[model samples]
Target: MQQPPPPIFPIFRSRITCAVLTHTYVGDKEHSITALAAATGTDSGTMAREVSRLERAGILASRHVGRTKLVRANHAAPFYGPLRDLVTIILGPAQVLSEELADVEGIEEAAIFGSWAARIHGESGPTPVDIDLLIIGRPDRDDLYDAAARAKSRLGREVNAVVVTRSRWEANKDGFIRELHSRPVVAVPLPHGNAA
Candidate 1:
C-alpha cells in the first residue's frame, strides 16, 4: 500500500522551510542545526524538530561531519523550485525592482544611486533604506513622475528616482550620471523606446 504524505506545515513553518531550502540549494552549503536556527531566527529545538520532519519527508538529508550534523537539500527534492521562489519573495524589493526595471522601455541603463549607490560602492557610512533609481531615458518629466508614483504604490514606499534624457545625460557627463557609473553598478536594460 502507498504511504500517506506528511501533513502540510503552517505558514510560519513554510517560511522556515523555504529558508532551509535556500541555504541548501541556492546557497549550496551544508549547515549545522545551530547555524540554520540562527539564520532563520528560530530556536535550536524548533529547528531540530523541523529538520527532522523534512528529513522524514525526504526533502532534506543529514550527515555527521565530525561531531556536527550537517544538513542539505536532497537533490531529488520535489519542492526545490517553489522553495526558491519563496526565498526570492522574502528577500524583498531590491531583487524585485531590478527585475521590473529590466522591462521598462526607453531606458538604456538604470542604476541605484545617491547614498545607496555610495554604500554599494563601499564609500558610505550607512545604507539608505529606500531605493534610488538613476534612469537614462527620454521619458517626459510627467511620465517619469507617474512611473515613480506607481512604483511607490506597489512597493509601499517612495522610490526616489531621476530620469534624464540621453541628450541631457551626455551634456551633463561630469555630473551625477558619470559619478554613478564610476561606482559599482547594478545595471538593468530598459526597452528600446524607453532608452535615455
Candidate 2:
C-alpha cells in the first residue's frame, strides 16, 4: 500500500519561518531579526523579509525595543492555536530529538514509539505527555540518560528510553520488543558517520 503524504506547512519549509516559530513559540523568546537570522542560520536579509511577511500576516508581531525590532508569535492570531499545536506536537519534537541524539554513540537504530508514534501514524487522541524512545544498541547508559534529561527540558516533555543490545533486538524474542517493533514508529535518523 502507498503511504500517506507527510504533513506540510508551506511556511515551515523556510529556515526563517522555523527559526521564528522556534524562538517565539518553542524557545519562548522574542528575537530581533538579526538574532533570529543567526539562530535560524539564514541570512539577515532573508530573515527580515520572512519576518515582515509573517508580521503582515498576523502570525508574528514586532515591536521596537530600543533600536532593535523584537518579534514574537501573535497569540491572538486566529491561526495561532492550530499552528502552535502543529509546531509544538509535531515539527518541534522530531527536530529536537534528532539534535539531542545526534552525537550519541553506539546506537544502531533509534525510533519513537508508543502513543506519540500512534498519533504520528494517524491514530488521534490526546497528545502523549512523554516521548518513548527505543534504542537498538547498547549505548552508554549515563550519557543516554543525560541526553534524555536535556531533551526533556528542551522539549518540555519527559522522554523515556529503552536500550537493548543488537542481539536482543535482532532476536525479537521478548514480548515487549516484539510489540514495539510491530507498531508504527517514527525513525530517528542518525547523523552522518554515526552508527545509528
Candidate 3:
C-alpha cells in the first residue's frame, strides 16, 4: 500500500476520481479498497462503490487475490493517457504535497487553509493557483521551505507556508486563527508509521 498524505480531496466536487485516481496513477500502483479508503479519507464502502463504477466504465481494472481485490487505473482504457495527464495536472497537488512532506520532521500537524481549501470544501470559485499551508510545530524552517520549493517546482504552483507553535495554535484566539477554524481546513495526514 502507498502512504497517504491527506484526509480528503474534494477536488472537482467529486471525491470519486480526484483523490483516488491521482494516487493509483502515481507510480502506476495497484491499490486495494482499504488502501483507497485510507488514501482518500473515505470508507471502504464508498471506495468499493466508486471502484465498481469506474471498473464498469473501463476506467479502472481490478482482480481478486483470494479475498483482497486489488485495483488500479486501466492502462488499456481508451484515452487513458490523456485522462491521466489531465487529472494529474489539475489534481496532482495532494499527491505531490504528500510525497514532499512525508519525510519533513518536526511537524505535529499540517493542513491546507486558503482558496484551495475552500475549493476542496465544495465552494464554487475559480481554480486556486497556489497552496496555503499551515504547519504547527517546530520543524526546521529550511527543510519545510525547501520541500515547499520542490513541490512548487513539480506542481507549477506557489506554496506559501505559515508556521505556528503548537502552543500558540492552541492558545491564540486571533482573527486569523478564528477564520481558519471557521472555514474548511483540509487536514494533511502525517506519514504512516512515523512517530509524531
Candidate 4:
C-alpha cells in the first residue's frame, strides 16, 4: 500500500521558523499567530499546529489574550541567540558592499535598496534578483560605471546599482528611492577588502 505523504504542517513549520527568525525579534513581545501565518503565507491552522510544536521545543511561548492567542519568543529558548546571530551573519554582505562603495571618491553613502531592502526589513518576500544599490555621489560618469562593474566582479554577482549625486539625493530625500538609500544596514567584508 502506498504511504501517505508526511503532513504539510511540518513544512509550514520549517518555513515559518526561517521567516520569523529572520524578520522578528521574538522575545517577550507578543505576536499574533494569525499575523505570522499571513507573513509566512501559511494557513492559520498550520501555524497554530507548528506554533505548538515550536512551543514544545522551547522556541516559542503562547497565551490566550482576549479572543486571540498571542505567541512570543521565549528568551530562555536555547536556539534564540544562535538563530539571531545567523540572520545577522547571513545579511552582513549587504553592509560590507555599502561600506565598500562609500569608500569611492564622491560617494557619500551607499545602501542595499529596493526589493532587497524590503526583504531585509521583513516587509516583503525574498527574490532571486540582483542586489540593488543606491549610491550617493558625483563621481565622473566613467568612474561611477567602472566602480559598479568592479563591485559586481569582486562580489561574484551582478549588482544592479543606481548612482546619484549627493545634491540630487538630498533634493529628492522624500522620494522612495532616497528612503531606501537611508535604510538600516548590515556590513560584511571581503576575504580581505581586495578588489580581486
Candidate 5:
C-alpha cells in the first residue's frame, strides 16, 4: 500500500480528503478500509464510516473482494482534481516525502527538523521554505539526492537531507545531532515498521 506522509491539516478539518487522497496520491490503488484507517491515523471503525459517507457523495468508490472491501479515489468525481491538488500540492509534501523516503532501502530512520518542525511544534516564525531531514543509516547518496530532488520539484521547496551513521546517531556525539534532538523532531516511519 502507498504510505502518505501525515497530513498537515487538522485531521478533523480534512478527514475526508485526507483519507481519500492519502489513498489516491501515496496509497496503493486500492486499499482495504483497515489499511486506509491506519494510513490516515484514523481508527478502523471511523474510517469505515467516513468511507461510506464519501462513497455516498461519489468521491470514492469501493468493491468487494471476498469479504473485504477495498476503497480508492474516484477520479471521475468532479472534485477529484481540486482535492488531489489540495493534498498533493498545498498540504502533502511532508506526508509524501516521509512516505517516499521510508521505501528507500538502507534508510533505517528519518525525522524532520527545522522551521517546518518548529511550526508544527507551535513555534512562530516566517513560513519555512525548505524541509530539513535527518536521515539515519547508510542509504545510497545518489538515491537520496534523487528523492530529494523530486520532492523539491513537486513541493516547490527545498528538501535538505543530512545523513548520519547509526553509530553516531546512537552515541549522540555530534553537536549538530545533539542540537537536533533538542528541537522538535517528528519521526518518520520506515516502511512496514514503527517510527524510527
Candidate 6:
C-alpha cells in the first residue's frame, strides 16, 4: 500500500488534538467537552483527557458550573495569541467553510484546491494568500456567494469559489482541471449533522 501522506501540520500530537484546539480557539466562546467530542468524532472520555492536557498546558481554560464543564481557549495565557493564530491559519478555512456551507443546497462535492491545499499536503511554499474552494454540482448562486463572503471574513483571507459542473470535473478536459486532479486537495467536510 502507498504510505499515507504526511500531516499538514505535525505540531499537534494527533489530528484530534488539532481539531479540539481549533474548535475551542476559533469557533465559539466556550464549549462543553461532550459537545466538542461529538463534533470531532472522538469519545467523551478521550475528549475530557485531552481538555485536561490542554488545561495543564495553559492553552485551554475551563470552568465547572455545577455538573457542566465549559472549556475555551485560555486567552489569558502568554502564548494564546500566537497559538490561536497558528491553528486558525492551519485549519480555520475548512472549519469556516463547513459552517458557512452546511445549509447550502446541491453540493455534491466540495474541497480546497490550489495553494492552500498544496501547503496543507506538505509542499514547501510561501504562505498561501487565499483559499480556492472547488464546488461541484449546481448550488444556489447567491447562497454560495454569501457563504464565501462569511468564510472570507472569518479567515482574514480571500476565498475564491469556482463552480464546476460534475461532468466537467469528471472528464477533466483541460490543463487546469487535470492539474487540480494531480495535486493535493483538502476535502471540505459537510457538517457532522448533515453528512450523507
* Strongest candidate by TM-score: 3
**How many residue pairs clash (N, CA or C atoms closer than 3 angstroms) in each of the candidate models, in the order given?**
9, 0, 0, 3, 2, 0
Q: Across residues 68-120, which tens digit of lDDT does each residue of candidate 3 receive?
A: 99998899998788777666655666667767888888888888888878766
Error of 3 at 148 (Å): 0.8
Give the whole-model CA lDDT for all candidates, comma-separated. 0.61, 0.75, 0.77, 0.56, 0.72, 0.83
Query: RMSD to native for every prediction?
Result: 13.4, 8.1, 5.3, 12.4, 5.2, 4.7
Q: What are the clashing pairs of model 3?
A: none
Per residue, candidate 2 scores C-alpha lDDT tens digits across 89-159 of 55566556777787788778888888877765667567678899988887778878888888787667899
**1-196: candidate 6 lDDT, tens digit per residue:** 1223325566677656877887888765798999999987778898999899989999899999999899999989998888887888777788779789998887888899988888667687777889999998888889899999989887888999999888999999888899889998988888544322
Candidate 1 backbone collisions, by pair: 105-194, 106-193, 106-194, 106-195, 107-194, 107-195, 136-196, 137-196, 166-196
What residue runs in model 1 are displaced by over 4 Å at the alpha carbon? 1-94, 102-104, 121-124, 154-156, 171-174, 191-196
The candidate scoring highest on lDDT is 6
Query: Candidate 5, after superposition: displacement of residue 51 in Å?
Result: 1.5
Q: Positional deviation of 78 in candidate 1, in angstroms? A: 17
The whole-model C-alpha lDDT of candidate 4 against the native structure comes to 0.56
RMSD of 1: 13.4
TM-score of each: 0.44, 0.59, 0.79, 0.42, 0.74, 0.71
Query: Best to worst by TM-score, what's the order?
Result: 3, 5, 6, 2, 1, 4
In candidate 5, where is summed lDDT lowest over 10 consecutive residues?
1-10
Candidate 1, which ten residues in sequence have the lowest lDDT sum? 1-10
User: Which residue segments of model 5 deviate by more than 4 Å?
Assistant: 1-20, 98-105, 118-127, 191-196
Indicate the TM-score of model 1.
0.44
Worst 10 residues of 3 by lDDT: 2-11
Q: What is the lDDT of residue 19 in candidate 6?
A: 76
lDDT by residue for model 5 (1-196), tens: 3233333444423544554565655443788988887776777887788788888888788899998998888878888776666556545656767766765777878888887777555566776778888888888888888888887876778899999988998898789989987898767656754323
